[model samples]
Target: MRCSSWIRVAVASALLVFTASAASATLVVPEPSDGIEVLVSSSCRDRLDVSLRIDEKSSPGELVFTLSITGPGSTRGDLRGFFLNLADESLLDGLSISGPFVTGSQLAANAVIGISTGYTAKSHRHAGGSSNPFDLGIELGTPGISKDDLQTVTFTLSHATRALGLADVSGQTFGVHAMSVGKGRCRTGSCKLTGVIPVVPEPGTALLMGLGLAGLALPGRRRA
Candidate 1:
C-alpha cells in the first residue's frame, strides 16, 4: 500500500473516533411514572419555559450547555436556580463549570449574572422541595435571565477523571427555579421546573461518519 493510502486510513479512523465520542442532547419533561415531578404550579407553568441543550466539547471530559428560559407572549419571569443529576454520581466531586454567561444570540444583551454551584440540591429552595435530590446546584444572581427580555445562559461542564460524552448526562434529571412569575394568574413569587435530558443525533456527526466510512473503503495502491 502507498504511504498516502495509509495516511488516508489513519485520518479517517481518527475522524470516526472523534465524531463518535461527541454527542448532543436536549432536556424534556419527565413522565409521572418516572417518579419525577414539576413543582411549578399549573398557573405558573405557562409563565415560564425552560429548555437546555448539551453538546460534547472538543476536549475530552468536557461538555457545553445552553440553557434558555422564556415565557409565552404574555407571560414573563426570571431564572433563579438550576439543578441536575449526574449519571455517574462519583463525577460530582470532579465536576467543574466554566464560561457561564447569558448567551449573546439576542439583540439586546442581558445583564452579566454570576453562577454558583452546590453539591447538594437541597441547598437551593426549589430543588430542595422536589422529589428527586439533584446532584448539582447552579444558582444565578439577581436580574437573572429575564423571560420578558428573552435571555439564555451558556456554560461548560468538565470532569476531572473521565472523558465526558452525551451518555453522561442523557436521561438525567434536571430542575430549574424561576422567580417573579407574572403576566397571568400566577402570583408574583417562584416556580420549580423539572425534566430529563434526551440524546439527539447531530448532523455533523452523520457527515463525519459517512466520510470516515468512505475513506476506509478507499482502494490502496500496491507497489509493483
Candidate 2:
C-alpha cells in the first residue's frame, strides 16, 4: 500500500478508537502505561499547579500514585492531606496504603487517609474553605514536595476483596492540601489543589493525525 493510503487508514482507525474511548465513563491507564495525570484546577490551580499521577501497578488490585507541583519554576510547600473517593464506599474497609510520611487514617462521612507526622484537625481542615469530603484522605507529614520537584511521597493503593481496576478509581474525585506555597518572597501560606482530569488525544491518535496531515502535504511537495 502507498504511504499516503496507509496514513489515511491509520487516521481513520485513530479517530474510531478515540471516539469509542470517550464514550466510556472510565479512562483506562493500563499497567506499564503512563498513568493518568490529574491537574489541580481549583482557585489556586495556576498558583499551586500540582498534579496527581495514577498508575496501575503489577500487583493485583494495586495502584500507585505520585503527587507533585508543576509550575512557576519554583515553590515551597508541604502536603498536609490527600483525599479521594472510591467507586464504592465499602471498598474502604479493605483498602491499604503505604508510603513515606503517612502517619494515620480517618473515615468520617468519607474515607480520609491521614498522612501527617502530627495529625490534627487544624492541619486537616480543607484549605480554600471548601467542605467537600472524600472517600479516602491521606494526611502527609511536614516538608512536602516543592517546585520543579516530584518528592515527599509515593504511595500504593490496594484492596482486599476486589481486584480493583480502572472502574474502581478512574475519573474519581481527588484533592490535596499544601502549606507554604511559593518561594523567594512569593510564598503563600497554603493552598488547596483539586483534581482536573484532562481530555487529551492518546499518543497514537496524535501520531495518526500528524501522518494524515503529512500525507496530504506530500503530493504538493512532490509537485513543487
Candidate 2 structure quality by residue, lDDT tens digits, 1-224: 00010100111112211121122221222322444555553334225556666665455567877876565466555666678867667878878888766665565445353433466565565522335566767766645344322334677888777676545665456667776666756655567655423333456755555556432212211110
Q: What tens digits encode model 1's per-residue C-alpha lDDT throughout 105-176?
A: 101111112123422223344351345355666655444334333246666777777777767765566666
Off by over 4 Å in 1: 1-42, 57-60, 100-123, 126-129, 143-150, 184-187, 199-224
RMSD of model 1 against the true structure: 17.6
Top lDDT prediction, candidate number = 2
Candidate topping TM-score: 2
Clashing pairs for model 2 are 78-144, 111-135, 111-136, 112-137, 113-137, 113-138, 114-139, 115-139, 115-140, 116-139
Query: Cα-based RMSD of the predictions, in order?
Result: 17.6, 12.9
- Model 2 residue runs over 4 Å out of place are 1-34, 41-46, 109-117, 127-129, 143-152, 185-188, 196-224
